[model samples]
Target: MNSHYDVVIIGGGMVGASLAMALKNTALKVAVIEPYPIPDARGEGYQPSYDARSTALSWGSRLVYQQLGLWEKLSEHVTPIKKIHVSDRGRFGATRLAAKDYHVEALGYVVPNEWIGMTLISALKTEPNVDFICPARVEGLKRSEQSTCITLSKQNPETGEYDLEPQSVTANLVVIADGGRSETCQKLGIEIQTESYGQHALVTNVTTSKHHGYEAFERFTENGPMAMLPLGESDGASVGCTDARCALVWTLPEDEIDAVMAMPDAEFMALLQTRFGYRLGKIEQVGTRHHYPLKLSQAAEQVRAGIVVVGNAAHALHPVAGQGYNLALRGVVALAELVSEAAGKGENIGALPVLQRYINGRYADQDKTILFSDKITRLFGDTSAGVGLLRDMGLVGLDILPGAKRLFARQAMGLGGTEAKISS
Candidate 1:
C-alpha cells in the first residue's frame, strides 16, 4: 500500500517472513509481497492429517528462531530429533548419532510446513514497520542507481485474474524468496544452475506400530536414499491413527515412480516395509502420497544492484540431507543483520556492495551443503557392487572414526562453515 519502502521482499513464505521478523523493531520500513494468501484454518478447527508435509529444522536453526522470538510457540508443535540413524540398506555398515553425545539437547526438530507458515504470517500482524501485501504479485521490474521500481498486479477475486496497478512501488532493496520456479527472478537476468538427479521423491506421512522414539532414519538403497523423519503425532484424535507418526521422503528413480505412486496402500506399505525395514516396527497406516522430481538448483547470481535472492530461489538442495531450508534460514539472518546495519548508518541497504557481502559470507556454506547433499545422493545411488562396498565401509568408518561423525553431524545440524550471527 505504500508508494515506497526500504525493503520489499518478493515472496511471503517462511524465508521472507523470517527476514521480516528479524528486521522487526529496526528502523527500516519493510514489505512482503505474496501471491498466495495465508490459508484460513479457523473455521473447522485445526486437524493434523497424516497427509501433512513436514520440514526438518537443524539445531542451528533453533538458535535463529529463538533469536526471532518464535521458538516458544514453535516448540508447541515441533518434535525434537534425538538421534539420527544412517544405514546402507541390506548392508553391513550403519552409523548412529545421538544428541546427548554431542552435548546438544537435540540434533534437529521436525515441524509441519503449514504450522511454520501460519505461525510466521499470523505473527506479522503485530509488526508495526513490516507490512504484508498478499494476493499480489510482481509483473515488472525497473532498476536504477538509487532504487528499484516494481509493478504490481493485484489478484482479482471475482475472475481469479490479475489487475495491474497504475502506480508502482519503489524500494531501496528487493529480496526475492519466491521459490525454485520464479518468473521474477528470470526477468531480472538471474540464471539458475540446476543438476537433475533424475529421481523423484515420494512424500507422505505414516503411522508405525511402534513409537518413533524421536529418531530420524536415512536408509540408502541401490537406487536412491529415503528418509523417514519423526513427526510427533497427529494434532487431534483421528480414526485409526496412533501416537507414532512420521514424515517420509522416499526417493525413487523416475522410471519407477509412476508405478509406485499408483500402487494400492497395502502394496505400497509392503514395499516400503521391505525397503525401509521394520526398525520402528510395521508401517501400519499411510496417508496421501505426493511426488516431486529431485534436483540441485542454484541461482547463478544471488545478488544484483538492488535485488537479492534467498531461499529456494537461490539454491534448492536434494532433501536427502534436509539442508535446503536450514541453509536458507542462515541467509535470512545474515541479510537481516546487514540490512539493519545499513539502515542504521543511513546507507543504501540495496547497494551492490551490501548485497555482495551477504553472498560472500554465505558462498562457502552453500557450497558445503550443496556438495554434501549431492554427494550423498550420488554416493548411495550407485548400484555397482564396488562402490556399494566402499560406501558401506565409509559408513562403518564414519561410525567408529574419531571426529568424522561429529563433523558430519555438525554439517547436518547447520552449525558448520562461516557463522552468520544476527547483529542486534
Candidate 2:
C-alpha cells in the first residue's frame, strides 16, 4: 500500500466517512484510518457508526446530501418528519411546527444510523482516489515541515486485537473525526472543555397504537426531555408489526437509568406513556433499550498547521436540540470546500493559512450551535418552578407567533444564520 497521500482522515465514523465522500471528486488523494473494520451486511458484529440508533437530519442537511448526490439513495430508507410537536408535560404550553407553514416538503428526516454508515461506506468504496485502512489504530502523530506522519497498528481481523508492527502513513493533512471521547485528540495535547449534564439518555424503538403521521414529538417532563421521532413504515412491517414505529430518546436522571433499563417492556412502556402521554396513542411495544450518559464537550482548538478535528472530536452536545450531527455536517462541508479550493490552487492543504481558513469559516456556526444545544439542554432539564414557568412561556410564544416559530424552525432545520459556502 502507498505510504503517502494528500490527506488522511483518522476515524471512519459518520463524520469521517462523510468527509471522505465529500472530497471524493477532488484531485487530492485521501486515506481513512479506522479502528474497526466495516461489518458484513449479514454479520451481527458491532459496527461503529452503523447501529440501531436513529438520527434526525435537518432539512439543510438534506440539501447538503442532495448536493452530494446521496439523497436519492437514502431517501427511501428515511421517514419524513412533516411536523414537530413540542410541549412541557402537565403545562398548557405547547408548540407545533409544520412543513406546510414553512413551504418545505418536510422539516427533517429520521434515518437509522446503520443506513447512513452503510450508504457512506458503500459510496466511499467506489471512490478511486480514497484508500480505506480499516481495523487500524493510529498510535502516534508527528508534524513536520512538509507533512504529518501518522503511526498506526493494524488489528487482527479474527482476534480483533492490534498485533501488527507499527506502520506509518505520511499525508499533507490529517483530519480527526474519531468522535466525542477521542484519545488521539487528548494525546495530541488538544484541550477539551466538558460539562456533565447529570442526565442519561435512554434510547429505544417503540410501536404506537395509532399512526405517528410522520410527526416528531419533544416533551419536557419533570425527569427530563423525551423525543419520539417517526420511523419508516418498512421497519415495522419487516418485523410483522402493523403499528407505527418511532425512535424514543428519553432523558432521565443518571442514577435512575439502571432501574429503568432493568424494567420489563410492558412496565417500561407504561412509564413512558405516563411521561410522554398518548400523542400517538398507547405505547404498544418497545425494542431493545440502550443508555448513555449525557454531556457537553468541545475541543478548545479545532485546527492547527497540519491537523484539523471535525465532528464529535470537536464538539459533542446534549441531544435536546438534535443539532450535534447537523452542526458537524456543516463543518465537514465547509472544510471540504476549503480543502478542495486549496488543492486546486496548488497550495499546501495542511498549511496554517489553509487550515485557518476552514476554521474561520466554520467557527461562528459551531459557536452558535454549541451554545444553542447547551442552553436548550440546561433550560429544559431544569425542574425549578421559575425555570419551568419561563419554559412554558417560551413554548407558548413559539406556538402563538409565526415569526418566532419560523426562526426556531429554521434553526432546527440547519438553515438559520449564515449558510455554509458548500450549501450555496
Candidate 3:
C-alpha cells in the first residue's frame, strides 16, 4: 500500500475509468480512487429504478470508446442517434443533420448513465494495470516538487471517518475527474467560473406508438429546448408495445419545475405533446422523471503543480447540447494521450511543462464548448422577440447553407474548431 504509482485518477466514473483503461497496456501504473460503491456484475442490470439519467455519445466519443475496446463491450445497451432534428417550434423550418451525409453509420449513440458506469467499472475490474479502490475516499492532497501525495480513508470524504486507517499514496501525476462538485479541485484551490441558469431539466424516457426511426429531436420552445433521443428498437413482444422508446430532456424555468412535476400524468403528457408538436406522436408511456438544476461551470485553469483536472472537475457545460460527457470524453482522451507521450519519451511524466501541455491542449475546445452551450441557453431562454427573430433567422440560414450546416453538425458532434480534438 505504500508503493508509488505512475498516475492516480481521483474519480472512477466514465472519464476516469476510460483514462485508466487507455493506459492499461502502457508502462504507466494507474490507480483510481472512488467513494461510491463500484458496480459489480451481479448489480449490473439492477440499476436504481429512480435513475433516469442518460447520455448522448457523440461520434467522436464513440471512436474513443472503440479505440479502448469498450464500444463493443456495451453495444447491446446503446441506441444509435442516426439523425439530429433541430427546430424552433411555431416558427421556421427545422434543420437536420443526417448520419448518411457524414458517411458514418450513426451520428452518436444513446446510453443510460447507469449502464455506462456499470460497463466501465466492469471493464476496469479486468484491467491488470489498474488498481481500483472504491468505498475509499480522499481526505487530503498535497504536492511536493517531485510528486503529489494524497491521504485516503475507507469512508466517504464527507463522513469524516477514518475506519480504514489513514494511508498515503503518491503518484507522478494526479487527475481529478470528480464530478461537478469536486473536492480535490477545491482542496487544490482551483477556481471555477459558473453561471447558474435559473432552469431545471426534467429527464426521463418516453415511448410513442409510432417508430422514432432513430431520429433525435431538439425542439426549442418558449420554456426551453425539449430533446427526444431515440433508443434501440423495443422487443415487439412487450405488453406496453413501447418498442420504440426515446430519452427525454425537458428544460423548464426553475420556478416552473415544481408545477410541471406536480401535474397529473395526463396533463404533463399533454404539455409535452404540445411542446414537441406531434413529432414523436402521442407519448404513450413515460418513465420515472428526474429533475436536475442547470448550470454552466468552467475551471479558470485545468493544471496545477502535480495534478491536472479532468471531466466535470475541469468543466461542466449545459446539457442543452448534451455535451457534458462528450466534452469530458475529449478531455480524458487528451490527457491520456499526452501522458502516454510523456511516458514514452522517458520525461518526468508529471512535470509542470508536461502537464501544462495537457492543459493547453484542452483549454480551447473546452472553452468553445462551454461558451457554445452557454450561448445556446441564453439565446433560446431569453424568449425576447428580437432574440427569437435572430435565432429563427440563424436556423433558416443554417438550413439553407451547406457549409454552415456541415460546420454545425461537426460542432454538435464535439468535433470542430478547437485545439482539443477527439478523433473518431
lDDT of 3: 0.80
Clash totals for all candidate models: 0, 0, 1
Model 2 has how many clashing residue pairs? 0
Per-residue lDDT of 1-424 in model 3, one digit per residue for the tens?
4369899999887788878887876878799988766768755333231134778998888887888888887676778888999998888747888999989888888887776777787887887778977667898988898898888877655675556678789999888888888888777788887888888999888878778988999988988888999876431124554447888999999999999998888888888988898877788878788898988787776887778888887788778898888888877777778888888999888799998888777677877887788888788876788888889888888888999998888888767654244452
Identify the runs in model 3 with alpha carbons over 4 angstroms from their true place: 44-51, 156-164, 233-242, 417-424
- Candidate 1 global TM-score: 0.95
Q: What TM-score quantifies how close candidate 2 is to the native fold?
A: 0.96
- What would the TM-score be for candidate 3 when compared with the true structure? 0.93
User: Which pairs of residues clash in candidate 1, taking residues 3 or more apart in a chain or in different chains?
Assistant: none
lDDT of 1 by residue, 316-368 (tens): 88999999999999889888888888878888998999888888988888888
Best by lDDT: 2
Query: Candidates' lDDT values, in order?
Result: 0.85, 0.88, 0.80
